[model samples]
Each structure stands twice: as structure tokens, then as C-alpha cells.
Target: MIHPPDRPTELGPGGDNAIAHAMGVAADEWTLLILRYALQDGVRRTAQWQQVLPISSAVLASRLRRMTELGLFSPVEDEEGAAYHLTPRGAALWPVLVCIWAWEARWAEGHPLCLPRMRHLVCGHQFEPCMACRTCGGLVEPREVTGSFGPSGSWPRSAPNTTMRRRSSGSANLGPGFFPESRALIGNRWSAAMLGAAYLGAHRFSEFQRRLGAPATVIADRLRTFRSLGVLEVLGDADRTDRHHYRLTDKGRAFFPVVMSAIEWGQRWFLAPEGPAVVFRHRGSDHPFSVLLLCSACSRPLTGKEMTVD
Candidate 1:
């Protein structure tokens, strides 16, 4: 197992499970937005991000600094000053980004942001991302899946043993602890907003502060927390401290699923009045696509009622 240098055994911001902890860390929208721009738009400079997005200078910088500490990006000397580039670890989140876009476009209806079509380079066609079992390469279905608690042993008292409904049986019974943890970490309003801004390409401290409207201390605390969790790290010897580049670690990159899943849930349960906020398509085809969640082992699409609890 890849234990972070800092955290030896703790999981979840609240000490739940490893998966829950990851969700809590990634629940920040600004961070995800920053990652998105890095992956899709190749944005690297402070002004370049601000020029395209709505974030101010301070908050942007704060998030960037935090990201640098996570190892998601690196700072390189540029002709003008410096630019933040995504590391290989950070680049691994491309699928998650695609998943988020797919969920928003197909499920969430009218939002202001327009999604770009994603092309599947492997298939040579515009297609949405779907989950598949890493083990069997089959589609994962909810009913066929089951989960067991790990050593953490902190399962919420309310959810001791969960069960999945059988699609073929036509029973839609979902057990407790289905999500495995509370949405507290990512659900925080400030954290979500900041993460969203970061994903949009904000990188400078001032830029983050201006866009988030959050207190300096709040930004600092969250960034520090992310760094401590091994989600983000600092780049090379940066020219400036605040202007230093930040990047995501593999752990941080893994949180992409939580973000995408949350977006899908919001689109279905708590959509905005206008409908879906944004749409995503195959980048190569420039055509709309779909998002499917599959089992890592079975490769079947997972549904709420279909998952089985162990």
C-alpha cells in the first residue's frame, strides 16, 4: 500500500475510511477546476488563468501554492516569470475530469458554463467515460457488487451491514452506509467554491483570495490540510513563496471520482432551477457523451439499488 509519508494510518478527515478521506479532500471545487484547466487548456500562468476565468489574484495564488505542495504541478522559469505545469501524477486525473463533464452534460440541465466535447483518442470517436472493472474488464453493476469494511473499523453506527438491490429481482433496496461516509469534507461551501476556482486555472494567492472572498486564514488552513494529507505539494525552489507552484499527488488525483460522483448526484437530486449547470462532450468528436459508473472488478455499471453490501 502507498502510505503517505505524513499520514501513517489515519483515513478520512474525520478518521473514517481511506475512500471517505479522499472524498473529503477532493470535495473542493476550485481545486478540481484548476486541475481541469491544466489538463485541458494547458493554462500555466497566473494572468492567463485570470484572463479566462473569474477568480481574483489572491485566492488564486493561495490555491496554487497549496497545489504545489501536493505535487500536482511544478513551477518552471518562463520568459516573463514562471508557469505551473502538471506533473505525471496530476495528469492521471484526466479520466475523472471527463467523468464529471459527462455527468453534468447528460444529467444536469442548463448552467452557464459550456462543456467541451471530449474525444477518446483510443477509440478515435467522441465518447463519454464509463467505469469498468479494473480486474475483469467487465461492466460493474450495483447489484453484483459488495464491499467490506477495512481495518479502520469506524463504520457509522447506523450502517453496520449494507445490502444491494437486485435488478433482475426487481427489488430496489439500498442499505445504509451506501456512501460509506458523510459529505462533510467536500460539501463545505467555502472549500467547494475554492476548489472550483482552482480547477478553472487560478494559481496565484491573490487570485485565489480575490475569487473566493474567503478569509486569508481559511484559505491557509485548507491548503495546509491538503498538503498534510499528501494531496498536494510544492514544486521546485520557487521564485516567490506565495507565487510558488503547487501540484497534486497521486492521492489527490485519485479524488477525482468523488468530485465526479458528487456532480452526478447533485444533477439528479439537487439540480439548479435552470437545469444542468454545464455540459461535456467528447473532446475529439466535439459531440456530447455520457458518464457511467462501473465496478473496478466486474466492470458492470453500478446503480444505487443494484449494489450489494457486505
Candidate 2:
């Protein structure tokens, strides 16, 4: 049986906060786009990425440099000039990408471009992806999973200081398969942190501010954005400011698989001396939560190489 920590563990600069570390590396819209193209379209050359993405050269270069430093992409010199390939670490993000696609396909409405159909090669069927617990080999749900923080959970130690690109007015031009809501929720570190806090039962406005140590204005802006996106709802006394309780909507809760996949990936790739910043356990099996992306059609575990976007 799993037990809660006796006291919050404090993480230093080199602390092991997998989720935050992962967010620092791949949570940006540009990074996500680059990974999506590389994984789905076999994009490698810098020129190829420029042609496919609406990003500027300077920003693209910056993203590539940072991603390479983060160990996601490896620079390769080929016969045809310079190119980038997903390192094993980068390629492991396939499940996180697939979960985003699956969520957007189900919840997002009236998108200008149709999302691609995912084909599971093993099952030979076009299907949706589902989250399953690797230990028991059973389907997992939001309610069945419990998350807790470790020493790396503190905002100061875990928050990524990378400068985020401000949301552009021309988001619609981001082409097909871009996850706007997911991007809003996860691309920004503060937004992702607050959402993670919410999942861990942080409800009041003060609670969010206290736990994240974020500026009140930024927290307020994110709360408003969450409400506008239908991911969170404000409940309780309308007139009383302190009584307002922020809660995740059903839509918000549905993002669990993406979060879990990211946490699992982070834990695997980014290690901290203090240990994992977050821990998730399966309530039904009382075992460590191990996320497995399974094909909705055949219920077989899906791997990066075995799935194709069509």
C-alpha cells in the first residue's frame, strides 16, 4: 500500500522534478509543433521545418538550439547538409503527442482542419488511444488515480524560466493538428502548474497563489483563461470574493492521460537527486501508477514505431 509523505521534501536547483523539467523542454507551442512535424511528417531539415511551420527563422533557430541543449533533438551532419533528428528521448514523446491528438479530436469542435486518424499497425485498425495502468493491465481513469508532490514540487525550484512566446493573434494559421486548448493548458508553465495543483486539490484563489508562489495578476489571468476555455469553473458565493472556488470541469479532468503520460516520460528521462517531484498511484491496484497508451480498438499497448498518423 502507498502512503503519503510525512512532510514536503524540499528540492534544490538540481532537484528531481520530472514534470517541471519536461515542461521546460517540450511544453512550448513551437517545441510541440516541431516534435509533431518530426514525428508525424518525417521532417528533419531546418528548411523542411520552416516550410511546414509558420514560425520565423530566428524563433525556429532559438527553439532548435534550446531543444538540442535539452537533449530532445540531436544535430546531424548529412550528405545533404545539416539536419536534426529526434533523439531516443525526443522520440519517447509520441504517447504524449498521441494523447493530445486524442483529446482534441474528442473535445474540440468546428476545427478548420480535420485531425488525422491514428492507425495502430499492430491491430491494423484506425482507433483512438486509451490510458491503461501497466501494473494491472486495466483501463485507468481520473478518479482511479491519485497524485502527490515530492521535494521538487515547490515553484521556485521547479518552475522553468524559459521565456514563453506570447500567444499570437494568428493562432488559426498554425495549420492542422495544433492543440490550442492543450497548448494553453500545458504550453505555459504557470498554467500547467496551476492545473496540476488543481488536480491535487488546490481550489481557492489564495490556495493557487500560495502553492505556486506566482504573481496574483498572472494567476488571475490564468484563472480567467481556464474559465473561458471551459476547462475550469468558478463555484460558490458569487458576491464573496474569497468564497469563489475554482474547480476543474469534466473537460479539464479529461486531460489526465496527457498529464500522466508527461509525468511518466519526465520521470523516465529527467532524473533528480531528491527523487520524483510527483507521484501517482493506482487506487484500484494499490501499485505505482505506470501509464500505458493502449489502442482503443485492439486494447494492445501502442509504441511510437507501431502507430502512424494518416
Candidate 3:
């Protein structure tokens, strides 16, 4: 069982696992898109989804089923066909999506997909964070977050038994020691692209490499990184030697939102006239960047200036 980060026991309203849960939900790209579409455009049958999203039928089914099991979506049956709607737990993801989008819009190159304006629900502001917060209010830097195995955990099967696990603390003692393995798993240009490709349903290594046009060595490196991080794993007895056909592990699946948020950030800020390098949306509101930042103890809005540095 995964020991979660330190969070208020009396949750206002959210899933049990929080970080772990969200990571699982957001781990894949299509899953986030499924949620985003439902949230933004309202519920539509799976067929409708197939048009806008290029994901394969098998992958879509898997994503929908996983999300349903996680309580992010509730099955709704109607004349058109069966569709899914966001639950409260899923709806809570908007802020995270929005924040990520805002970041991307600024830092990354963008195309028409990257809209000129994004509405901040909190302040009813139509400006970017740089202008809204940095110019007007102030800036809030992302806490260099870390992870750990927590009180009860086990090294993955592939991980070295004597692997050196590094411990990192948040600005405040926000959580347990962070597992550095997680970063080595995902922290790379190709790693994120791999996840993004998965979100778009490019499963095979050749497909990923062809679409991304990355070097074979780069692809192999990312795959190995994810494997060691326990994010991706070799599936059943089929093609163990090929090493091209792999799927996301439960751990990697949970980390989707973090990747999605990051992609959304890239999409908004980094997109050029061509198009977004990546795009992500909130599963609930399809609003992206809906989660709030608050104190673990007081649950108060934790601002950048408010944090006391160690």
C-alpha cells in the first residue's frame, strides 16, 4: 500500500488517495482528455469522443474503465448512447489544469490552440499569472517537491534492492521523504512526450519513435527510465523480447495528472504558430488547474510570500 503525503485528515471534499489517486487518474493522456471533454462539452457518447480524439478503441475502453473504477466518472445511459460524467472528486481537478495551462501559455510556444485569454475563476481575472500575479499581486514559485516510500512501501520488482532513495523536504515539512526514483522515471523531454503519445494512444515503440522522431537511443533511455521508476512495465508473456510493446504501470498511471498539468503548461506558453507541443484538460470541469494551494495545518490559502523558508 502507498503511504500518502501529509494532508489534512478532515478533507473538505476529495478522493482518499489525493496525490496517489490523482496520479493514477491523470497518468494517461486519453483518460485526462476523456474527463476534460466530458467536463467542458458535457457528456457525449464514446463514439463522439472517437472523432475528436485519435485514441484506439482498446485504449479508450481501458481508460474509461479505469476512471469509472476510480469514481472519477459515473456511467450515464441515454438514447444517444452510454456516456460518463464527472464526479465531485473529478470536478476538483480544474484549478490544477488551469494553472498548468496558464504556465504553458506563457513559457512554451503556442499555436491557435493556445488561446490568448484564460479565465481565472478564483479572482475573475482574464490575465496570465505573470501579469496577474507577478506584475499585479506577486509570484508564487512551485515548491521543489520530493517523494518517498513513506511508512509502509516496497521497492518495485525491477528496482534495485539496494537502490539509493533520496529524501527531499518541501519548503515546509509538507510531506514524507520523496522518492527520487519517480523523477528519474519521468523527468525528461521524451518521457513527457511518451506519456503524451500514450494520451493520444501511440503504444508501440516504433509508433512513438516515428511520431516523435526521437533517436532510438533516446526512446530506449526513456523506456528504461520509466521501467526503473515503476511507471511502465512489460505486459504479459507476449513479446518480452521485443521491448517495444509496453504499457503503463499502476504507479505511472497515477502520475498522469502531474504530467498532464505539465503538458498543459507547455501547451499554453510554449506552443508556436504550428500547434501545442502538448495539451491537457481537467477531467472534471475540463477547466485544467482547478486544485487550490493551501496549508496542510490551517488549510488556509498558502501564498508564496506567506511561506517561511528554512
State which candidate has the highest lDDT: 2
Best by TM-score: 2
Per-residue lDDT tens digits for candidate 2, residues 1-310, read: 1111221223345643767766765567788789988997789988999888877889888888877766777889979997988887788888888888888888876566888888998989999888888888989888888877775666655566663474574654665767777877877778888888888899999999999999999999999898998889999998986899998888998888888888777777765677777778888565888888889999988988888878
**TM-score per candidate, chains pooled:** 0.48, 0.89, 0.41
Q: Which stretches of candidate 2 lie over 4 Å from their true place?
A: 1-16, 163-167
Give all candidates' CA lDDT scores. 0.47, 0.79, 0.44
Model 1 worst lDDT window (10 residues): 157-166
Q: Write the per-residue lDDT of candidate 1 for residues 254-279, one digit (tens) a residue.
A: 44444545443332322232334334
- Candidate RMSDs in order: 21.6, 5.8, 18.2
> Over 4 Å off in model 3, which ranges?
1-21, 110-116, 121-125, 129-139, 143-310
Q: Rank order by lDDT, top first?
A: 2, 1, 3
Can you tell me which runs of candidate 1 are displaced by over 4 Å? 1-17, 153-186, 189-310
